[model samples]
Target: MRPREHASQIPPTRSASIETVLVVTMDHLPGYEIREVLGQVVSSQARTRNVYREGVKSLRGGAYDPAAPENLTRWRTDAVARLGEEARRLGANAVLGMRFEHREVGEMWMEVCAYGTAVVAYRSPAAPAPDQPLVAAETAHPAEPIDSGAIAEAPSAPNLRTAGETPTRPD
Candidate 1:
């Protein structure tokens, strides 16, 4: 078969759009500092099976797979996208502590929910150089210089019997 023409020209769907709002499971973003907590943002989507069709499929040995990976992924993506939209509306640049919950209503309906705390965040200032300590040298108390002679004259460990030698009991 000939190669498909203009395959790249098609615009991506809304669900597949570039994520503008950052969503992270961590309580805080590594390189970003949170400025304001907008509040909790939540999005839920529910899907129902066609009872008649599913019944027939099951009878014919082609049972519907509700827990299919693709279905679950799509559900999660859609829920998260909705959550991001809500966060954007709240003037948040990122969502922290994101969580996903799935619930089934009997055998017919499935619901996927995404929730997180929305916050305004900005990229944190660049970190100090590896060689530089977190605390300033001027404010910190200077470490005293070590005396090699003192260390050499320091008390040694207590005398003990060597291997295979029996220890004497104290009276």
Candidate 2:
């Protein structure tokens, strides 16, 4: 199979081309979750009066403080963008099994990782063609290795849902 190419070569199709696989380290951060943890720490330090205030300030000032949710959000966003760019370069229209890894370095440095498999995807083919087309059929088959030019002709699948149809729930 040929290596992936940047999105420029293949014009973006109307079909999603995007795949379903995605992964995240932290699923959701409800306000209550953050509040509860902070509340407990605050209450515990209340016994020492102003000590908690200093602790909070110090935490905020720390180079790798967890209090900075915005930094984490930005990191995540950039990582995803990088991953997407990599996928695009590989001629993959979608990424699957996406995941992130976080590592703390010493007292100040932290590293965040985002990774996934890049894939060239098209909507599922309808009825099979009687004879193989000019491009190799294996190129369109997910299990088979990819073929650059062969992928260009793969037909996109039709959307099953109508305008009024409700989306089906996952089992």
lDDT of 1 by residue, 10-127 (tens): 2223553314577778997776667779899999988886688677788979966655778788889988889878877777767799999999978999989999998777666787
For model 2, state the Cα shift of residue 96 in Å: 0.3
**Which has the greatest TM-score?**
1
Q: Candidate 1: minimum summed lDDT over ten consecutive residues — where?
A: 1-10
lDDT of 2: 0.45
lDDT of 2 by residue, 76-120 (tens): 666666665555545454555567677765554567777765554
User: Tell me, what's the RMSD of every candidate?
Assistant: 12.4, 19.4
* Number of the predicted model whose lDDT against the real structure is largest: 1
> Lowest-lDDT window of 10 residues in candidate 2?
37-46
